[model samples]
Target: MAQLGFEVRDLEIFASRTVADGTAAEIVHREHQTSVEVRDRDGLSFFVNTAEPLESDPAADGRLSVNMLWLTPDVPAAITDLSNIGARLLKTADNGHIADFAAKNSGKIMAHFAKTAAHGPLGFGYHGKVEELLERLLAAGIDAHLIDESYGRTLHITNPDFADQPSNPTGPTIWVNEEDQPDQYGYTAPSGTAPQAARLDRDSN
Candidate 1:
């Protein structure tokens, strides 16, 4: 495995209006002066800066829950490392895309590890690898979190609030999910699928 260095700085919250609705609200938490370095892999590194945040106010008529702007100052070392390991980094627009891609891939890796772990010896090996990879991701500045559930198998890389929407055009809004799974939502399976969840305009509902 290889190590990636991230210099994180200047974290601040900003306000913006939704494109769809003309309401105003705080949006992204900007991170400034961030840089990532990779060693012993492909000698590639990445530099990032958190740009201005985009809001999700309904009054602004915007569909975007949260919008983060990031740039790759240099080619990512992960790309080379993955290539050496017979994997490749998918093309994406920014770091957020890379983070999402990594999180999803990590989920699949964990699932396989879980299956092997059930066997005993191989399970330990799987767990070790999984832990190592997760640690690497975290050290590389990925925001990974476990979603509580019966299986406890969900891993997310971004904050949930980034997906929230205002309830009404001018009302306070919150993030909601319509996923047909049990985790944060206090619901049971076999009863019904997950209901359509949305950030209701605080005053509308």
Candidate 2:
């Protein structure tokens, strides 16, 4: 979100989707590929892209799983703080692996998604409190998008100031929450646990 600091790719200047006058209105952002960037407190960042459901069937929704984890010296504490604001902890990092601490791993890091969305036998619909989860990132100057997945919204955070944005002295650690049980995007959940955020380079398939 340009308003929040996350580099909103192809974001319309006047409006995200449209611009209108008293009697005139038009679509300013005519279907730009939705994308964005998210950064952590230490200044490291990652990119995310918009996604759609695997099934054409409306009843079939999807969920997201962690592909890799990014870590920092203070990641556990940082993420715990995030949980208080929003990133509701489904599972703590107890299940994930930890990477060696170093300069490259000094900054905050998060899991890279492997399967962003998971379809299920019965795709029941439920509202996940998506906005609340990523709202904290706003304070960190990292704007994120609640991508439309039909059933709900999915996050697609990219580096907004990646190449030129000023360094943020303070930014929150934000992670993408993709779920199949309830739906994707827009915070709300089945109370699944999340692994501790870690550095991806240290992780192996």
Candidate 3:
């Protein structure tokens, strides 16, 4: 998301894997997945697998999830990037602060974008079983919430070692969700529902 202001990481290390001949950012093609590691301004590194299936598993082939939702300084530019990729507009906030878009053929929202830089850069959802993952996190003494939704189970866990961010008072959170019946990231919101983008410190866990 270099276009959206996230910085690419470890470019030198992936020099041999660089495949984009003239692209601004170095697009690295790993053996099984074509991905580039990137970090937000907050130094949170996110592993971005582009287009291809993250793993060689057949079940996950051609599917990608909307794992991270970020707040951008520029919303229109972000919209251009998504629009260039032909992402479908799923929802948008009335006051134009938030928008959710999903890639073609994918069940989950590809990315959630917010206009203001006041808060967040929040992320949510996991590719696997949330209940099992939550249990493990709880065992490790992490602060987490396990919420059962009509579609599946979800967990909201507080980010560790990052409690001092003023913009993110409650620190950032990592959301995990169980796979829905369709086997893709099947969480869907009914059209016209207000976008309840998570806040920094408002923990209902």
Candidate 4:
């Protein structure tokens, strides 16, 4: 973890996916499970989890799935690390904001990395118009939703492969946000001082 410049913030465990999402918190109080929260040098923490039987497929190979998006300061260095471990490069953003890779011969993206930015850890996105993408998805008979956010316009679509259960109507979804989105981090007050500038400075300390 230290070699990768990652910091472990906290660890948590949940009985099921719904419990982890706060949906089944009242019905299911406890169960055998565990999870760890890890963050890169940029302070974006993502969870590595182990939930009960219902949350995930026990026999499925999870390596073929892309679950989290990690941010790194050095995109080339991060790509080198993945290549060193036999991971195959799938695609890279022309603007150097994102990189997708597959871990094995499965030909499926297992991990994704985005450039460090001020939009928080959820800043993973691509270069395109959100409205255009939404229209394309809807025209293709896919269920998609759009949100106009201050940071940028975002679109989320349900995973076509996800098996929706009664307990969880919305099984799994993907986020499609405009790349290089604007955020409060780039703001400067009229007095010539930025509010979030101080926060960023303190966070670095």
Candidate 5:
């Protein structure tokens, strides 16, 4: 059997106020086992489901209760059953919802190819919205690092010297000179300054 993963796409929110208070309680109780349902809106209707599982807990007041729900993929149902439930049979697409959900929740998604590199094959499957998720992370001020297939690691160079140091010492390495001295020479003064400048000034005079 193929392993199944759930992805949530669009979601709809319903509060007790949307329906008669008594009807709301009845509906909640009747639909406890059902994740997807058709809700009547001013005689029009739409299908709705929780993005995730729902749970109910007793409130501080003994007589009251609170419930939480999430929307996710729905199990395949017969068209007749769905129609009897008053739900319109909207078309279903491939599992992009999983990627969308991951992007929204984690602020990052990984393509299958990229994911395989960072994590071995046994790791979680990659979602296709990695680039969008990365943009979201960057906009939120979170550092988004990408590990390409060629390099299966996120590289961060925190040390100034580390960035300038030669990887193999085959050629000259570049360094930042914050103090106005030649970084290559390790000298305290510029070659054109002090005695050199004085001698040139003397010669010109």
Candidate 6:
């Protein structure tokens, strides 16, 4: 764990899927989730380098560089399902359940937040144009709902109770350095700010 640059025992994970206009939410979540800026303009993706999933992407295989994040072999979806279950439990205030799930699945982990994508094109907050994001989410097969103007964007595909919950006027309690995206469409985020970030930071890399 020391060699990995963190105390493994203290690690916690958070996984998110882009539902509505996640660009802004992605920015905030990046504060707690180690994130990398990635942009999808047309069919081309712009990043620090070529992008591909670690499972089959040779570029992400064992390559250790500031630009390239190394990863483990792909864990079966059954294992990732545990992460999904744990994440939902954590969201619902079930820490004990997450602990139990982690105790079982954290050992053979590779990377990812869980199933990400909008449950549908429901807008949350963040002043950016919601239509564009709505189109993206719809494209991904999520459903559509009302425009969320309350500045509470991030849609946790799990917590149904969180739907009507009021947004916290005070932003996040924890603070972090702000990193810039490389260019107009680039994505930027922390490296290992949180365990969840560590998990989502890679995907085919």
| Top candidate (lDDT) | 3
Candidate with the greatest TM-score versus the true structure: 3
Window of ten residues with lowest summed lDDT in model 6: 1-10
C-alpha RMSD for every candidate: 21.9, 20.0, 11.9, 16.0, 27.9, 20.3
lDDT of each: 0.26, 0.32, 0.45, 0.41, 0.25, 0.24
Off by over 4 Å in 3: 1-66, 70-81, 86-120, 149-153, 164-172, 178-205
lDDT of 3 at 168: 52
What does the lDDT read for residue 43 in candidate 1? 28
Question: Which is the better candidate, 3 or 4, if ranked by lDDT?
Answer: 3
Q: Against the hidden true structure, what lDDT does model 6 obtain?
A: 0.24
lDDT of 6 by residue, 26-79 (tens): 222233344323322111111111123335456531211111111212223322
- Model 1 Cα lDDT, one tens digit per residue, 1-205: 1122111122121111111122222223336433222222222332223334556466641211221111222224333332222222222223221311121112100111121111111010121223343465589886654444453333344433344743222122221211223343232222233322222112122
Question: On residues 87-191, what C-alpha lDDT tens digit does candidate 5 reach at each position?
Answer: 222222233221111212221111221211121111222223344445655687755444443212222212233347544221132111111112222122223
Superposition TM-score, candidate 5 onto the true structure: 0.17
Report the Cα lDDT for candidate 2.
0.32
TM-score, structure 2 vs. true: 0.25
> What lDDT tens digits, residue by residue, belong to model 4 across residues 1-205?
1112111112222223223332221122235534333333344433334322346679753322222344567665555544433344555654555555543212222233444522222222444567776787799999999888664576788767556442232246666655434453322222443211111010121
Tens digits of per-residue lDDT for model 2 on 53-158? Answer: 3445565323222323433444443353223112323333333322111111112223222222111111111124556545755667776766665543555455
Worst 10 residues of 3 by lDDT: 196-205
Backbone clashes under 3 angstroms, per model: 18, 33, 0, 0, 7, 15
